[model samples]
Target: MDILKSLGHPEELINLFKFKIGGCRTIMPKLDYESMSESLRTCYQYLNQTSRSFAAVIQALDGELRHAVCIFYLVLRALDTVEDDMSIPLDRKVPMLNDFHTYLYQDEWCFTESQEKDRKVLEDFPTISLEFRNLAREYRDVISDICHRMGVGMAEFLEKKVGSMKEWDQYCHYVAGLVGIGLSQLFSASQLEDPEVGQDTALANSMGLFLQKTNIIRDYLEDTQQGRAFWPKEAWSQFAGRLEDLAHPDKLELALSCLNLLVTDALRHVPDVIAYLSRLQNQSVFNFCAIPQVMAIATLSSCYNNPMVFQGVVKIRKGQAVTLMMEATNMRAVHTIISQYSQEILQKVSVSDPSREKTLHTLALIREKSTLSQSSLQSRTHHLSPMYLSAAMLLAALSWQYLNTTAVQTQGTGDMQG
Candidate 1:
C-alpha cells in the first residue's frame, strides 16, 4: 500500500529516497576529524549516526558553537531516550527523567531500554557525556539546565493524559519550547550572536510550540497506532466519541474536522514564529531555524483540511524542501514562504467546515503580517508540470542516492551516517 502510494505520489518518495542517499551532502564537513579529541570524535560519530537532519545543520554552524551545539543535541537526545522509553517501569523512568542532567556528568550512566531506533544513543552516551564535560562552563551550564527542566517536565506528564489546550502547551514547552530557549542561550553564549537576540522567551517558546503542534497534528495516525495521544481532549472530544474514533474509516469527515481545528489552533503561533526568526543574526543560525519553520508551515498547508492526517503521513515534497532550504536565507524569503503556505491553507478552508471561521481569521493575520511584496510573490511561485513532475522526481531521487553513496565513499563515512 505504501509503495503504491509512493508511486502514485512521487513527492512522498523523493525525500525518503533522497534522505536515504544524499539529502545534506553539500553542507557536511569532510570526513577526517583527526584534529578532534577521541571523545569529540566518538560524539560526532554518534550524532551523525543518530540524526541526519540535525547533524547537517550542526556541522554548518561556525566554530566552537558547532561543537557546543552538537554535544548539546546529543545530551538532550540521551535524556529524551530515557523519557520516550515507554517500556520502562514508571518508577525507573520518572527518576531517570528527573536525574538525566546529572547523568551527563557521571560519564558512566547508560540506559538500555530505549526504543531500537534510539538504543545506540543510550548505549554510547558516555562518549556524549565526555564531550559534554569538555564544553566551556557557560555552554555546559545551559545544556544541563535545559535537560534538567525538560526531564522534570516529561516526568510530570508520563502518567497523565493531555486534557486541555493549556496542558498541550505546557507539554510542548517541556519537550520542545525549552529547546528553543536553550538554543538561544547557547547561541548567545557562543558570542556568535548578540545576547539580546535570545532574550524573547515568549517568541522562542512560540517557535518551539509551533513545530511541536504541527508534529502532533501530522503524526495522529502513527501516535494512535502506537497507543500514544498528544492532541488534547479539548478539541478532539468535540468531534468524535473518542480520540481514536476519528481514526476509524467510518469517521473520515469528523476526523478531518478535528484535524483542521488542530491545524487552525496551531496557526496562532505563526506571527510569533515570524517575530523570532526576524531576530536571528547569523546566516547559518537563520538557515537552521528558517528551514524547519518553513517546512512546518508547508506541512500545515498540505495537511490543512486534508483527510490524509488520518490515513498516513502527509509531508511537503522534497522539491519544496530543497527550494526552501536554498532560498530561505533571510526574513524576506521566510515571509514569502509563510505567505504562500498561509494562502494555501486559506484557500482550502471551506465555509461549511466546522473550523472555517477560526481558520480564516488565523490565516488573515498571517497574510496581513507577512512582509512579502506583490512583486516578490509573483517571482517566487515555482511548480513543475504535473504530467512529468513525478518522472523527473524519480530520476532526481536516483541521482541523490548515487550522490549520497559516492559522497560517503570519498569522505570516509561514519557508521549509520544516513
Candidate 2:
C-alpha cells in the first residue's frame, strides 16, 4: 500500500524495496546486541522503543561514540518524558528537571511512578545511570553537562507558553540544539571528528534548531490537540484569534498563512545546516547527522503552503524516507537532496502569501549554498516509465511476501526440531 502511494516516485520505490531486503545494512549497520553488557543492551532496547526515527542512526554511529550517544539519548528521553507528562505536579517536575543531571550520579534513583508511555526509562533509571557512570570521563562530562542545561531550560519553559520567536529558539536550543552540541562533542571525544565540530556551538545549535523547528511545524495538529503548543504566539496571533483557531475550517487561509510563516522561519536555518554538515569528517557521524537534516527538509517541502498540516498529519512517504536514508551518505548527495527539496518549496510559494518574500529569500540562500550543477539536479526517477514503475512495485510486493512466508516456515521448522 505504501509502495502504491509512492508510484510516482520510482526511485523511492526501488530504494524501499532494497531497504526491506537487508540493503539497509550497508547504510545503517547495527551493533551486536548479544556482545553488549547487560546495561548497555538494555539502553539500546530503550533507544529502539523510544525513537522510531533515531534508533537506526544512533546504532549506526561508529565505535564507543555509539554507546555514548545511546546513553545520552536515553537520558534525554527520560527527561523529556518527565517534562511531557502533564499529570506530574509542577513542583515535583520543576525540581526533577532542574536536578536531572545530578540523578545520573546516583546509583539507585529509578522513578517508577511516572505515567508516560516511555516511562520505562525512568522506571529503570539505575540501569541507565549505571551505564552513564561507566562511560569515559570526557563523554560522561559532555552528556551530563547537556543534561543539566537542558533540564534547567525545560523547567523554565514549564511556567509559560512560547510567546516570541526568540523564546521559541531558546526552547528548541535547550531541548535539541544541546543534543547536537553534545553529540558533536562525543564524536570529537572518540577521535572520529575534529575538535571544532564540538567547539563551533553556533553551527551545532542550528543543526538542532532545523530538525526541531521542522517537527514543531509538522506536528501542529497533534501538538495542539494534545493541549500543547510550541508555535510562537507572536507568529500564530497574526493569522487568527487564537492558535487553535487556525485549525477551524473557516480559517484555512489564515491557517495556511501562519503555517507558511513558520516554515519560512525553519528554512532560515538551512544555510547553517549545510555549513555544519560540511564540517563533518567521519562517514558514520556524517550519515548520522546528515540523514535527519535531509529528512527535515523533505518534510518541510511536504508541509510548505499545504493545508494538510492544519487538518491532519503531514509526513513524507516511507519510500521517500528510505530513499533519503540510502542516498544521504555523502556530502554531494546531501546537497542534491537539500537542493531538490528547496526547489519543491520554491515551486509552492504563493505570491499573495504574507511570508512569500522572506520564504523566497531564505530559499535563495539555501540554493546558493547547497545547489550543485544542473545535471546533478535532475530527478533520479525521470527515465522510468509508468509501465516500469508498476512492474517494479508488483515485483517488490511479491518478493516481500515470499521472504515473509519463508521466514515463518523456517521458524516453524526450528520450533519443531527444538
Give the best candidate by lDDT.
2
Evaluate model 1: give its TM-score. 0.88
lDDT of 1 by residue, 64-145 (tens): 9889999988888887777767788899889888988888879687876677677788888888888888889999999999
Best by TM-score: 2
Task: Kindly report which residue stretches of model 2 are placed more than 4 angstroms away from their true locations once superposed.
Answer: 379-390, 404-418
Model 1 lDDT on a 0 to 1 scale: 0.81
Worst 10 residues of 1 by lDDT: 1-10
Superposed model 1: Cα runs more than 4 Å off: 1-32, 381-418
